[model samples]
Target: MKSKAAIMKTSGKIELGRRRAVWELPAELANLHHKVSIGSSCFLKLAPRPSKHWDARRAAELAVGAGFTLDKPCFFRSQIAFLSVTKIESLPDSVGPKMQTLMVGLNPSPYSSASRVPYGRPGNRFWPAAHRAGLISKDRDIHHALVHHGIGFTDLVRRTTRRAGEIDPPEFRSGFERVKSLIEWLKPKVVCFVGLSGWRIVSNPKAKAGIQPASIGLTTVYVMPHPSGLNAHASLKDLIGH
Candidate 1:
């Protein structure tokens, strides 16, 4: 009997025997040639290097954010290891014209990024509250909400973080401008911000929850409490109500 040899290829390279792989990034990716090591356990480990512009840990993030499907990297001891590469870190905007409402979140959490779903973190009350509020026909179904309920989803910032507090005010300001342009173009009936902190910094410092006087073109603006489980300020009931 003869043993079988297996070979696999992805967007990057896998060098046999050498236990090293180099990602052939496109020119638009700033010509990054990130290297990784294939361990005996069949895990891809990022090879550390000193670079002022690029960080090894962020290589996978950048790839996923650029619409590449890749496995997320995890920390193994002191080294960063990837089980596979096939998901995105940044959630894409799911808005379309004639949308009844556009739900804007603060940013993508690491959990949500790995799951490839907006507000997908298990502890996050967004889906549950939206379901209870009759905003979506199916729980955690973004497509169903958009198609059936006219509810769209987007984020103020596409960056993924463990906590929303990590996002800077400048990011919020810039993100708001982008959202404003989107609203102006899509012309959604209502723009609902799922986090008050972002709206407060971008639009009004003392902005309160609910419908605001501000309007992006003809779209109404509404501020809601953050649906994060860590946000004790607003309960699930309060989120549903908002």
Candidate 2:
């Protein structure tokens, strides 16, 4: 016996089998057959013919509509559109007491939100610079840094966006309050901001890279150029030096 293929309607809702699990799709993406599965992580598999319409941005929007966040979209060996998703809308702060340094970013991108690792995006130079700077023994391992190196990760804003420019000034101010509270409680020796933009908006509009004069509670603040590949002002060596 063969089970009939599930159908998605223009309303972007579909019920699956007896489990009755529902997924919301965009109108343009409707009528596609999707397979939803859960493992150590959750994945939404969409089987649509290869078309110019399907891209990473559209996939991200679809995932957001369904109350999920996605990593970089990929294709399975079978050429199916594979999207790994997290139910949470934003990346959670990875922090602990007895921290040497706390690294903060402006916000989460879809890449990091899905992987549950800050700066997990491939083109992002954060991990490489961290490794070169002797901050972490292993690359791209947040747990390793937290557990072994006494380094913690967090973000100024909990929102996830494709670009940091998409975040507004109000979010930065509110997020600074949250980060300030966290620092006062944890009292890390140093608080390192991966980008100057967020700190500049919230604390010092004219702030340049390196240690800032103001302290968040008793913690010293250090600002570094964003390690995003798109940020060409700083080179890999410059980031390592920071």
Displacement of the residue 100 alpha carbon in candidate 2, Å: 0.5
The Cα local distance difference test for each model comes to 0.63, 0.68
Q: Per-residue CA lDDT of candidate 1, range 52-144, in tens?
A: 322443444434333334445544333333434432355555554559999988887777655657888788898899889888879877667
lDDT of 1: 0.63
Clashes by residue pair, model 1: 70-85, 70-86, 70-87, 71-84, 71-85, 71-86
In model 2, where is the ten-residue run with the lowest total lDDT? Answer: 15-24
Write down the worst ten-residue block by lDDT for model 1: 25-34
Q: Write model 2 residue lDDT over 1-242, tens digit each, in one string.
A: 01244544323323222222112233222212122322224555555555444444444444443334555564444434456665555665656667899998998898786676788888889999989889999887766787799898878776688988898899788777767866776689999998889888999999999999999888999999999889999999999999
